[model samples]
Target: MGKVKKTRKNTYNYNVDRKKLRRRAKKKSAPRIQCDEIRNAWNRSKSLAGNMAEMGLVADPNKSLPIRERTVIGEPSKVRKPYVLEGLKAAASLPSKQTMGISSDMIMYVRHMVENYGEDYKAMARDEQNYYQDTPKQIMRKVNLYKHHHTKEYQTLLASRTKQ
Candidate 1:
């Protein structure tokens, strides 16, 4: 057989070492004159006199300037009353009503069916606690929802029943 070519493993540092060395070599070989001029120009522009020149303002050499207090144009001195607190108070005064999910009575009915009848959906449908008169399928669906929501409780109930 002919000599097989070796393959390198893919990694973050693959070929990075050689590229870093090449970059270092290139940087060392480059002239520093232009870099030094650019750095000096940057330092000059960052000075106080340079800043005043950029802003079209002249600095007075004879007298020291006084620091002026910054004033906000439209802000009021007094704190305003929050309207959100009033809305929250209004909401708190009203009685709360359950708008989503099954009612507490429905939950109690499902729990009764599960505890008394177990998985016997037909028996659950005929149960007096099932005031809605849910069909076998509807009873099964409600039982499933109850099981999903109260898994730990359902398991404990089953364990207690088995123990009895």
Candidate 2:
């Protein structure tokens, strides 16, 4: 006489667990993106973009830099975020007609900062509004303070991944 062996049936139907299975499959196939890798990617890609811009390889400086005007004109003394001030400075150098950063890299520099930095453009705008509303010199002071932090705090922050 021969003995018969029985196989166990599948407990989870393919349809019933399809979502979880898909998630598990995704997890197995794709690895997580680490913070350092992201920062490094930013470091690499941003400079490359700037270089491309500097070379005149890329068209439309506005497209590359894309600084949205966030500052509102205040009556008198007020706050002015350095980021906005920087944008204004770079913009001032732009050709009166259209082109930007004729002989220098100010446009590229500001573009890189806006693109790679941690703070949101919206936040910069809000700060500019508040600073401008307070006093005429507020924006300049804010810009100076922000620039001063570049020597100490900003370096540490830049070393880490910047999340918006």
Candidate 3:
């Protein structure tokens, strides 16, 4: 004869109230004081005639205070001075692109490389304009530098190329 298998009895209560359990699990915090209550307390303290008030340290809250007129200080004098031509005029006249270390020739070279090789740095190195005899790595660096400095122009170039 085969041995009989024993059945396990269920211990968990299926009728337990989940809402009551959740309520019991929630953390209780102290009620916060309102800002108006704090302000009223401050006003009450200030209104009292204390030793600090007698010493003229704390101003009387009941007394009307003067409205301080805003005055401008350390402002430049309006007197006109003689016009001086500093070397800054030359720098100011130059184009924003010229301010970057990458020259126009280098930009043109990079543009040409991209237009022809389409990011093939080794092929770009073999191109006729690789007059500097820059290796593939050096050419890639120059291209990346150009792209970084002139992002908008590079984006436009790509967009135009895609349209073609």
Candidate 1 residue lDDT tens string, 1-164? 99999999977767568978988998886534343223333333255444333333223433223355543221233213234234446766777675346667767887777778777888878877776788999988877777776788778776766676
* Candidates arranged by lDDT, highest first: 3, 1, 2
State the TM-score for model 1.
0.37
All candidates' TM-scores?
Answer: 0.37, 0.18, 0.38
Give the per-residue lDDT of model 3 (tens digit) for 1-164: 99999999988888998888876666332223343323223322333333223223233443424266543221224212112122235545768864558888999998988887777899988999999999999998998999898999888777776777
| Runs off by more than 4 Å, candidate 3 | 1-100
* Rank list by TM-score: 3, 1, 2
**lDDT score at residue 67, model 2, on the 0-100 scale:** 73
The superposed Cα distance between candidate 2 and the true structure at residue 11, in angstroms, equals 6.8
Clashing pairs in 3: none
Candidate 2 per-residue lDDT, tens place, 44-148, comes to 334544433333333344554447854322311332222434454676677677532222243233234434544454444444334334332443344345546
Model 3, residue 24: distance off in Å is: 80
Q: lDDT of model 1 at residue 78?
A: 24
Candidate 3 lDDT score at position 21: 81
